[model samples]
Target: MKTLGRVLTAMITPFHADGSVDFDGAVALANHLLDNGSDGIVVCGTTGESPTIANEDKLTLFRRIVDVCGDKGSIIANTGSNDTLRSVEFTKQAAATGVDAVMAVVPYYNKPNQKGLYAHFKAIAEATTLPIIVYNVPGRTGGKIIPATIEQLHRDFPNIAAVKEASGDVNVASEIYRRIPTDFMIYSGDDGLTLPILAVGGCGIISVAAHVVGKDLNEMIQAFERGEVTKAREIHARLLPIFDAMFVTTNPIPVKYAVRRLGLPAGPFHLPMCEPSEEEAAVIDAALKMIK
Candidate 1:
């Protein structure tokens, strides 16, 4: 199985002023991230506003980003959703795009039981030859894929290589670490919990804060790996403000604003997702001042 690297940015989808997907901007952003500290890019995940992007646009992004950054670093496509059949078909399509891997989020809204969750991921894993990262963010998904379920899936599918544990509960992550094989990876799906998750044997993070602070985040992870616990803690403390800022408003809103402020190719947000409020922008600005 292939490793998708330690720090994967859950990248945002850049847009044109007219609300169209900005393919050129995406290529630029992908290169920018790889040049910084991102080991891979997870395009069209929650941070990318996947709910709003069209399927054809997502496929285009998967192909285009892979073409541009495939050799430079990993390019992971988010092809999973609440629907099983659609996820299976999309995972196949995304795999054909030459992306290094695919991420399937825990099915949301319908709140499937553990058995259903197992079946859901089992079908996705069986569909493709690419490595699979099972995303488990119960806060958004309205349900949780307990550790036993995750362990079962990992045991059943060799291709189900990792789980992005975003439950925000360290005990849960610790339990998962104790249950799974050491070779099976666990990633922090939440930026704020990266270090704690790492302490409990998480591999790295599928991060949002990485857009502005990738180098610093990577340094922290490396510091931990080298047993420089003090240095890692210091970096995490310094980054806490930026981490807090990114979520001052709902996810991609503040993060998209931060990316635009950096003079990158990030553009306007689609409907239902809009610009940050003035108060939220102020908080984000205060936090961004800490970068560099």
Candidate 2:
């Protein structure tokens, strides 16, 4: 399977002040990220507040971004959930929305074993012709899809294209790299590990900080590909603080605040999530300055 572009923003969902999904703001942010430097956009992923968003809203958002971006970049949707049947159903619906692909995460909370993991993903893949990007963020999803299972899925399904690796274990990523086919894609789900993952044969990143520093992140990837390893390291070091700040609170809180702070259309976070603390806000502000 072929890969999407290197730098994909796990984009944040922009909201209205009243907590409604801000469709216009989302379109604007999608355009903004692509124009700035992101090669693709992953809508409704963890960063996009998928937990709070309704299914209808996700379909609507997918349509808006696909309509705006057209063939310019990949507009991938997050259709994964704890329920395999629900994931399969949503994946088909998302494919109908004209997104380039759909990402089904490792089922969180249910904590499926490797066998269950492979079965869950295989079911989703079988239901849709759209390429599947299997997300394995153990921090978010309690189970880890080991390399053997991932390789098995890949061997079984041609449409099972990539994995968003956020296990925060470089060794696990390295093992995946060593075992999987060279053509199979492995993307760093964490921003700070982009360069390290690349050094170990991972392809690129699906990033949060890219919402703010996408140009730098894209440049870092290009630099590494060009054999300018030192320059890539410098870019990574320069970006470290912003990456840390975005997660200072739970994701989307700091990032949503960061977007609004930059005067973008990002409104506010939804319930069960709120604005960053004064100190966290200060840290985010300072981190934004490093790039500015």
How would you encode candidate 2's per-residue C-alpha lDDT over 178-199 as one tens digit per residue?
A: 8884878889999999999988
Pairs of residues at least 3 apart in sequence or in different chains that clash in candidate 1: none
Task: Please list the C-alpha lDDT of all candidates, in the order they appear.
Answer: 0.92, 0.90
Report the poorest 10 consecutive residues by lDDT, candidate 1: 1-10
Model 1 TM-score relative to the real fold: 0.98
How many pairs in model 2 have backbone atoms within 3 A of each other, for residues 3 or more apart or on separate chains, i.e. clashes? 0
For model 2, the superposed segments whose C-alpha errors exceed 4 Å read: none
Query: Model 1: per-residue lDDT, tens digit, 1-292?
Result: 2358889999999999999999999999999999999999999999999999999999999999998888988899999999999999999998989998899999999999998999999999999988899898888999989999888888889789888998889988899889984778789988889999999988899999999999999999999999999999999999999999999989999999999999999999998999998999999998888785
Q: Which prediction has the highest lDDT against the true structure? A: 1
Q: How far out, in Å, is residue 65 in model 2?
A: 0.8
Show model 1 residue runs off by greater than 4 Å.
Answer: none
RMSD of 1: 1.1
